[model samples]
Target chain A: MLTKRIIPCLDIKDNRVVKGIKFLGLRDAGDPVEVARIYEEQLADELVFLDITASYENRKTLVNLVEEIAQNIFMPFTVGGGIRDSNDIRELLNAGADKVSINTQAVKCPDLITESSRKFGSQCIVVAIDAKKENDGWQVYINGGRTPVDLNAVEWAKKANELGAGEILLTSMDYDGTKDGYDLELTKNVVEAVSIPVIASGGAGKLEHFYDCFSQTGASACLAASLFHYQEYTIKQVKDFLKGKGVSVRQ
Target chain B: MIAIIDYGMGNIHSVQKALEHFGAKTVVTNNPKDIETSDKAILPGVGAFDDAMSELKKQKLIAALNKHIRQKKTFLGICLGMQLLLQNSEEANKSDGLGILEGEVRRFLDRKGFAVPHMGWNQLKIKNKNCPLLKDTPDNSYVYFCHSYYPQPKDKNIIAAVTDYGVDFTSILWQDNIYGVQFHPEKSQQTGLKILENFVNLC
Candidate 1:
């Protein structure tokens, strides 16, 4: 059976791991490689490194960091943030990243999704959608949730799947960093909207939150940052809880 | 030394890195000469079946790989590399594969809730505990997988292990000198590393 994935997202800024509440007021976490090794030890199903580095010039550091992490960690990991074109995707994959997540570039040129997927295979292309609940539905946000777009969340997810994206990293900007819980409704809508696997992201506070997202939304995976970063709950603890709850988790 | 055949299909770095982690010397090459000279070779790929077959042909790796396997040298295929070992695939257009294994690659049917790609960690039920590739690997151990199409071997005796999603599919296959895994052992963490190590330690 394909078990529900438990991912630990390491938001990178200036090559250092950081976590922010609602994508603001970032706090230092630790070194990327070191934190990654710790997660690997904790039996993390996968690791997501979101390079929040601001300057395009510093992007080379991310590639170097990815190579270093790949050398040390044997588990599958994803590199995202500031990935603009096919070249970026190729560079990351060559550097040993199993997948590359694209945000703003995907919206700016939706063709990137199709082109990259065609070139590198859809399994390696992940479209990260940052969404916030609006009027009657949710609107998509890009540029690390700083800019709002006219696209609807569910529609964008379906469009991304149609555009050849293998997976959707759906993060709720409203629930992000709140430590409340996942946006079950938004996740469920998107999961139902697309046939590709949907990774539910943002607002993972407790063990039950992880269970809730899996049970309520049928998400293929759940990604958390601060909850695991601060050592409030270990991945083993979460997986154990889920296992006890009859959730099919990789133990 | 192990040669990882790279036909420009997908990433081969992780495969090389994982093997090297087990202290196995590896070279990533598209040249047939490298593959021919290596004692063991790994065909690691990701992408559509036809594209991979075309790339392998363009690189002239088909004859070299078949020669390597015919010579009774150990050969392993990962993901699309595994699919390419079969007779043909039903992806895109009906296309021929390497024909080394008597099987056809088919896409997963659109079940009610099962995803097509069948991504993430899944347990393996080892059928052949004597297979060297699964030497120390325990039954029901989890491994990483990401693919929409899976190979259905005509010879069931060649299947060494199987995994379930919506159906029980051949996750690992072994014959005399050729082995193929639908999962990415390099990216499957510890159990994956163990399998890679087993391959590396094969004499």
Candidate 2:
């Protein structure tokens, strides 16, 4: 049986971690490699590093950071944020990233998904969808969730899978930062829409939230940022809690 | 020194980095001479079987790999690299593999609940505890996997370990001098690292 994954997402800006990590006995919390090492120590299943740098010139820094992190950490990690073309994906993968997530580019030019997936393998292409509930349907958002697209979240997920994306990282804009819980309906819809793995993201406040998303939505993985960044719950604690709940988690 | 084969298919860097972490000197190369000269070699790959086979042929590594194995030198294959060890794969249009091992790569059936690709961490049911590659790797230890196709060996005795998704598939393959793992040991955290360490220490 494949175990559910617990991923700790780290936002990167200009080669450094954006969100403050409050891990104890750490020299530099903003360092992506250091923070990733801490999560690796906790036995986190995987890590996602989203490069949120605004400028285009900082892309080189992101590549350098990925190389440094990959050299040090042994666990699988995904790098996303400004992935535009196949070259970007190639550079990152050559730097030792296991997967690369694409967002706005995927929506702006969906052919990128097809081309990159074919050039590289579909297993390394992840389509990150930032969605917000609109009326009864969830609408896809791009440009870091500041702009809305006409694509439906569930439909987009299916299209991404069709476009050869290996996985779907579905994040709910409404539930993010609130820590209320995961967007179960949206996640469930996307999970059902695609045959590939669905990683439920955003609004992971408590241990139950992770369980709820996995148990209720049939999500293959759950990703949290502030919940783990604040040291509220370690990854081991979350996995242990899920284990007690009869959820098959990687221990 | 270990030779990490770079056939321009998948992420060979991660494999090299993991081996280096265990203090194992590694050289990433596509040249047949490098692979033939090395005491041990690792074939780490991702992507479709047809493409990988073509790339390996384009780089002229198939014969070198066979020579290395025929010499009784240790060899390990990871992910698609593992699949390429078999005789053929059902991926794409059903292409031929290296034929080093008597097996066929089959895609995971579309079961009702089970997802395709069988991605994520899965536990290993170790059948041969005596296998040196599994040293310090406990039974039911979790390892990272990402693939739609898995190898079904004709000789069950060669299977050292198995992992269950919708079906029990061979996750670890071992014979006299050749070894293969369907999982990405470099990305499987401690258990994966332990396996890599054992492979590195295997003389």
What does DockQ give for each predicted structure?
0.74, 0.74
Model 2: lDDT of residue B198: 95
* Candidate 2 TM-score for chain A: 0.99
Write down the worst ten-residue block by lDDT for model 2 chain B. B110-119
Deviation in Å, model 2, residue A150 alpha carbon: 1.1
> Backbone clash tally for model 2?
0
RMSD of each: 2.9, 1.2
Model 2 C-alpha lDDT per residue in residues A1-251, reported as the tens digit of each score: 89999999999888888888998999998899999999999999899999887467987888888889888898889999888888899888988898999999999999999998877778889999999999989999999999998999999999999989999999999999999999999999998888999999999998999999998998999999999999999999999999999999877
Output DockQ, candidate 2: 0.74
Candidate 2's TM-score: 0.98
Q: Can you give the lDDT of residue A234 in candidate 2?
A: 96
